[model samples]
Target: MENRSHALMTGFFTITLLIAAVLFGLWFNRDRVERVPYMLATTQPVPGLNPQAAVRYRGLDVGRVSDIDFDPKVTGQILVSLNIDPDTPITRSTFATLGYQGVTGIAFIQLDDEATGSPRLATNSTNPSRIPLRPGLFDQLEKRGKRILAQSEEAATRLNELLSPANQKVILGAFADVSATANAYRALPQQLEPVIARLPALADQAQGTLQSVSALAADATRLTRKLQAPNGPIERISGTVERVGLSLEAVGNGVELEALPHVISLTEDTRASMRALKNTMNNLNERPQSILFGAPGTPPGPGEAGFSAPTK
Candidate 1:
């Protein structure tokens, strides 16, 4: 009886000690932080995602997924529940996506805010605030895979058409033409050698022509300057012309003031002489012997002069 009681007491002490140790461990592992509840809803598939998956806010661990279920109210919609730290700053603009660990296919919730200044999301145990679950990288790729495949097929078809036998022949012909052009380019310098050799002579001739033109221009400029000089040949010629004009004026003045009077007197004297000569000519015509004999004596006149009546 004593041995049995001792064994029972020892077993009880050991069990109590194990129980205290377990309680201490539970106390140590208890979460003291208050966590806020959030809900995420989506119609997209969440591959490799399960309950208790880590929830991250911009790559930081902020929470854990609590439950994943289908919405009974909305058909074909999934609902994911999360318990996040209260300080995680979940807001109305916050969204969720599934991220994967490297090559492990383990999916976690990735939370991101579209706008940092969004109003805080309100939640309670009965009605948690909802975050939208958007498509992940793999989901987007999977969704676009058919279109990408179609485009790739189109590109491959175009490539095959472009590389057909006819196009290949055309490409070879173009390459041959390019080679011919390159050969022509290589021979261009030799073809231009004669013209290049003659360039120096041509340049010398052009220089000589330019020098001759310059000399001509200089001579013309000098002649123009001489012509424009104040006391040059132009001035001398102008002075001579002025003197000639003055002499002509002086001759005109002499004719008007001195020679004009003499000319008038000479004209009157000549006129009187002409009148007497005309009278003498008339008398000689009447008497032919008047030139040799003196004037006939005056005959008795009726009055006082020699006037006589002829008897018939």
Candidate 2:
């Protein structure tokens, strides 16, 4: 009876301790627990994704994927449901992306929002609160890798084409031409020897011509300085021109050549009349009273020969 009582006491104590541990655990994790629902729709392959996968927003645990199923009406589309904490700000702009468990290939849901002040997600008849799933960084890198691989392949193909046998033959021919050209260049110094030998004579001729030119330039400089002197040919010429101008001004002040033509005409008329009177006298001396009977001949009129013109 004593043994039975001891055993019963031990069992009772064990049961009580287990119940207390359960209660304590519930209290400690109470704030950490959450279950807010959201729906996600995706058409892309969700590799390594499954129900109960962790959902994180900016690296903090916010929820878990609760279910995944294909929509009956939409081919190639899957409907995913999540249970997130109510505090999770899953706005209208919020989206989900696949994240990995570092080398494990295990995928989780990563939520992010870029739209500002957008309304919270809501359910519709055809679609639930659709937190659109976009390709993650890994998926983008994978696509870029595929593109790079294709480009590399194309470049290698072009390179192979460029290095084909025919092209190689052409390259060899070009190399041969280059070698011939190099040999020609190597012999150029010998070919230039004769021309180089004449360089000293050519240089002497050039020096002599330069000396002559220098002498001529000195002469020209001296002549230029003489012409530019204060009392040089230019000054003499200017003085001579001034004297000539003064003489012309004096002549203009004294001479009245503009009336010379009228003076000459009057003098000719007077001289002709005088000669006529002299001739009449000579005729009358021979004929005595012929003036009364009319002289032997009439005297000459004006502008006749023997007229005395005027002088300037």
How many residue pairs clash (N, CA or C atoms closer than 3 angstroms) in each of the candidate models, in the order given?
1, 0
- lDDT tens string, model 1, 164-256? 999999999999999999999999999999999999999999999999999999999999899889999999999999999999999998889
Candidate 1 collision pairs: 301-307
- C-alpha TM-scores of all predictions: 0.59, 0.61
Q: What TM-score number comes out for model 2?
A: 0.61
Query: For model 2, what is the C-alpha lDDT against the true structure?
Result: 0.88
Note the Cα lDDT for every prediction shown: 0.92, 0.88
lDDT per residue (tens digit) for residues 144-249 in model 2: 9999999999999999998999999999999999999999999999999999999999999999999999999999999999998999998999999999999999
Q: Candidate 2's error at 43, in angstroms? A: 2.2
* Superposition error at 49 for model 2 (Å): 0.7
